[model samples]
Target: IALECILLLILQQIAAPGPQESADDSPGIALAWKAHQIIRSRFHLPLSTAVLAKELHCNADYLGRVYRRTFRLTLTEAIHRQRVLAAEKLLISNSLSLTEVARQCGFSDTSYFRQIFRKHTGLTPAGWKQRYCKEHINS
Candidate 1:
């Protein structure tokens, strides 16, 4: 339930226009943007707030706070969102199994992947794949 709420909040944020950046926060906002870019490229690897903070040369708490302020979502939320989006692309035309998709998306656990996928898209991975397969037989 907590995960569902978080996912919903993230979706809402993405759906809505984002907050404008304050001049005072330009540096931190840049850091957050860079962090997200890094996450997109390396999200399939084991990543954590501490690791991201270290990479960005900022305190973990500070990074989280600024990122949340700038993006209205946490780093973890962003990561999970990216993973789910990536999984959606793969599921469209790929024949990978659930486990493989999870692994490819940096989810170490298949069940966790399913849970996040459901929270993000309101459908389990299998259900998503089934629906897509039926709609697009080219896969």
Candidate 2:
């Protein structure tokens, strides 16, 4: 009986995430990880805070608060960052025009896409393309 109890305690300790932790414990790190998964999987779609909250099984306000705290940026800002990074890559491809790049990155308006791109990069889409082209030629 003593050996059985000892073995059970050892197994439980080994299975736990940390000291004083319960098996059902959900930490901020876990929540942040789930949030990242949800964003990556659904980011290209037109999604609202309510929709993301529902998908994550949290309140919109709470989700936004925790997400911003965890990522140091608001949910909308994070999505925009992702979209603009994608747009920058697309701009380099030379196969797709700015309109197509905007559409592919889930931007509903080309003008809005250009605006956001410029806001994040300090350069408009055309300027970014031109700078990259100039750098390549100089190299």
Candidate 3:
């Protein structure tokens, strides 16, 4: 009877859901979500993998891995995407110069901003603004 009870306990333990099985409840998912929130709220500030990891109190490499796994993009890519979205809004809503737009969007270098903006938007900042203005004015 003692042997049967021990075997049953072992089987129950084996069948139970462990931390690995409940991926949605894992810390990595939480960390990734927190990182996403931080990026969304602070994208206009300087940020990076190390900066985010420090803010989240996790290892930078681990944060990078988890963020990439959860979002299918690196931290740098996510930051750039957020910055580009902000730039797009500024480009359309006002007459801010490209350099000012870059500065306000957290890009330290106007040239790099142009490159990344073009990469994500398929148009230069000036070109995008011109097109947007023309389209909206005609409407």
Q: Top model by TM-score, which number?
A: 3
Q: Give lDDT for model 1.
A: 0.84
lDDT digits (tens) for residues 14-62 of candidate 2: 4345666554444543564576556656666776667777887878887
What lDDT does the true structure give each of the candidates?
0.84, 0.75, 0.85
Error of 3 at 36 (Å): 0.6
The number of clashing residue pairs in each candidate reads 0, 0, 0
Query: Compared with the true structure, what per-residue lDDT tens digits does model 1 show for residues 1-139?
Result: 5985796577445534347544677677778777877887999998888999999899999989878876788999989998998999898868888899999999999999999999999999889888888888755
Collision pairs in model 2: none
TM values, all candidates: 0.80, 0.75, 0.81
Better of 1 and 2 by TM-score: 1
Which portions of model 2 miss their true places by more than 4 Å?
A: 1-26
How many steric clashes does model 2 contain? Answer: 0
Residue-level lDDT of model 3, residues 30-139, one tens digit each, is 68779987998899899999999999999999999877766678999999998998999998888888899999999999999999999998999999888888889878
Model 1: worst 10 consecutive residues (lDDT sum): 12-21
